[model samples]
Target: MLDSVRLYLRYVVTSVRSQMQYRASFIMLSFGHFLSTGTEFLGVWALFDRFGSVRGWALPEVAVFYGMVNIAFAISEAAARGFDTFEALIKSGEFDRYLLRPRSTALQVAVREFQIMRIGRLCQGVIALVAGSLAVDVAWTPGRVALLMAAIAGGACLFSGLFVLQATMAFWTTESLEIMNTVTYGGVETAQYPLTLYREWFRHFFTFVIPLACISYFPAQAILGRADVLGSPTWFQWLSPLVGVGFLAVALRVWRFGERHYRSTGS
Candidate 1:
């Protein structure tokens, strides 16, 4: 496993170096990504400026949510660029090369591409998280800090699962994946706020369905020492990482099923 990880790292570095061959275009694309996501943070700031709070959650609290979601998203997009753009892979017949390899399909698909441009977005997320941490009045504890890191890691896994699921859909049809975007991109947008801010159905969709909030809001409340207005037990907040794991498990199962279908149908 360690050797495999090292090989994957080398594969990613190679891809990054290849992408850097076009230095000017790469820099412009990276800057474009930074500016696009920076506008998202600006939108959040504007919302806070217009309204002191959203559903009683303060600006710093929402920033925590925004930062965590974006951080997870950037990490997933960078590492899982292949699965994230699986439709193109299928269309371009690149997935067939993955099948020819003896390595795990998932790992090969994961390392097939690496979006170095997303480093800009990742940097933005780091800055936002640090600034939000400074702005919030949370009592810092070692356990809480650990939970924050775990939450970010779990969220990244969960979002990667969503990307895999989206890619898996290519086996069936490749018209347009606007519907999956609701879960992938839309989930990111919705999760950047307290889960309790949403209505009952939306909260339930997130908790029992996608569970994006499990990685951010619940763990965040634990870190912030805030009460769960959504009536989730205190222990649920501590155990929220499991939700992301569970989502990933389900998504992987679905992806495997899709692979079987693709192999059988040759589509």
Candidate 2:
């Protein structure tokens, strides 16, 4: 595992250097990434302008939710960028090229591409996180701070897992990517606010089905010292992020299965 991690780091560094070589295009793409995601904050502001709060969650509170999901997704998107473009690999038969290599296909795909532009999204999330942390009057403690970081880590795992799953689908569905986008990208847009703002059914799907609430909503409530709407126990809130690790595990398992399927069927 240590060697694999070292190899992954080398791949990431090489990818960064390659992107840096195209200085002008790289800068424009980075700016575009920043601007596109930065627009979401405007939507949040617009919502606040019309309604004071969404289900009693104030703007600053929502910012916490926003920041958490954004940072998580940004990290996931950056690391798992290979999965995002997996469809193209399938179409062009480049996935078979990965198969010829000795490394794990999942790791190969993960390191195949890195979306450097998503750094813009990370910046936006950091800005929101800092602003929201200042706006809210939470009496911070060491443990609470640790839990917040854990939750973000968990959220990142959850999202990366989702990306893996999305890519795994290409083993069967090689040409289309629309449906998975709804879950991966749409999930990001939906989770940017407190889950309580949505209906019970939507909450149930996102919570029990995708487990988005486990990564963001429940943990944010715990951080803020608020009563959870869905009756989540305190223990669950603290531990929910670990579910993300599990989610990523499941996705990787599926990816392995997909790889086997591809090998069995490929020429």
Candidate 3:
């Protein structure tokens, strides 16, 4: 495990250095990421501006959810760029080489690329988190602070799992499916606000099928000290973020199953 972690760190450092060699391109791409996501937040802000609140959730409260998911997803996107582009590896028969390596194939594939440009979206998330936390007037006790960090970590795991699952599908079809985007990118857009704002079926899909709400909505409720209309217990709300970790565990098992059954492209 330690060797794998060290290898991953080396991969990250190499990725950062290579990207930094073209600083101008890196800066512009990062800024583009930030600007695009900023517009999305502006739309959310406009909604709250038009209606003071939606379903009793004010802008500040909702911003917490927005910030957490964005931060989490940005981190996942940066770290899991390899999985996002795994189809290239399969198409070129590069994945066959991974199986021959002494180290874990999943680890090798995961560390194949580490995007550094995602810092822009990450910066935006931090700003939203800090500003929203201040405006929401929540008492930031030690426990609350810990919960906030845990929620972010769990969310990152959840998104990483989604990316792994997306890559795993290539083992069968040799092409990455577009439908998964509905659960991934779509889940990002959906989880950025209160789950209560969505309809029952939509909420159920996210809750049971995707469980995106567990990392953002439920944890945000605990952080905001708000009562859940769905009547989940406070203990459950506090622990919901861990569900992301469990989800990732399940996704990894599925990935292994797919990997074991893989028939190479035979370059």
Candidate 4:
């Protein structure tokens, strides 16, 4: 485990050094990311300005959800960038090189590239989350704080799972990968708001199926001291972080299946 961590660190350092070769481009790309996601924040603000609240959830409460998801997403995109962009790796035969390595294929794929630029988005997310917490006037208890962090970690894992699942499909065909973006990018957009604001089917899909709500909505309810409207019990809300491990397990299984398929077909 320590050796793997060291290998990943070396890979990250190498990526950062390579990115630094084009300092201007890196700066511009980072700024562009900030600008794009910053616009998302404006949309939330506009919604709050027009309507005092969505359902029973207020703007500040929703910001917590937005911030948590964005932070997790930024971190995931930065760390799991190689998997996130796996279609290119497969197309360019880079994934085949990964197979030649003695280390775990997943680990190799994970550390292949790291996007330092996404730190800009992460900074913005932290700011928004802090502002939201202050705006909502929620009392800070140790448990509440821990749960909030867990929610963010869970959301990160959930999104990372989506990326892995998307990449695993590359073993089959990369022709229609855009469809997978709906779950990845679309889920990010959807989870930014309170899940209760969405329709029953949509909410149910996120909750019971994709389990996006497990990271944000359910935990948010506990943080805000509200009751679940989706028929989930209170204990589940506190246990939302477990969803991350569960999602990763399923995604890994799917990935292994895809790997086996690729080996057999050589496609």
State the C-alpha lDDT per candidate. 0.87, 0.89, 0.89, 0.87
Candidate 4 wrongly placed segments (more than 4 Å): none
Report model 4's TM-score to 2 decimal places: 0.95
Give the per-residue lDDT of model 3 (tens digit) for 39-96. Answer: 9899999999999999888999888889999999999999887898898888888887
Off by over 4 Å in 3: 263-267
Residue-level lDDT of model 4, residues 1-267, one tens digit each, is 899999989999999999999999999999899989999999999998899887777888888888888999998888887887888988887778888879878788877789999987998798888999899887889999999889888888888888889899999998989898899889999999988688889988998789999988888889888777766788989998789769977998999899889889986
Off by over 4 Å in 1: none
Task: Show how many residue pairs clash in every candidate, following the order shown.
Answer: 0, 0, 0, 0
Clashes of 4: 0
The estimated TM-scores of all candidates read 0.95, 0.97, 0.96, 0.95
Error of 3 at 185 (Å): 0.6
lDDT of 4 at 214: 90
Candidate 2 residue-wise lDDT, 1-267, digit = tens:
999999999999999999999989988987898899989998998898789876788899888889999999998889988888888898899888888989898899998888787888999998998798789987689988998899889998999999999988888877666789999999999999899888889999998789998889999989999998679899999999998899899999999998899889873
Better of 1 and 2 by TM-score: 2
* Candidate 3: residue pairs that collide: none
Worst 10 residues of 2 by lDDT: 169-178
The C-alpha stretches of model 2 lying farther than 4 A from their native spots are: none
Model 1, 94: alpha-carbon shift in Å?
A: 2.8
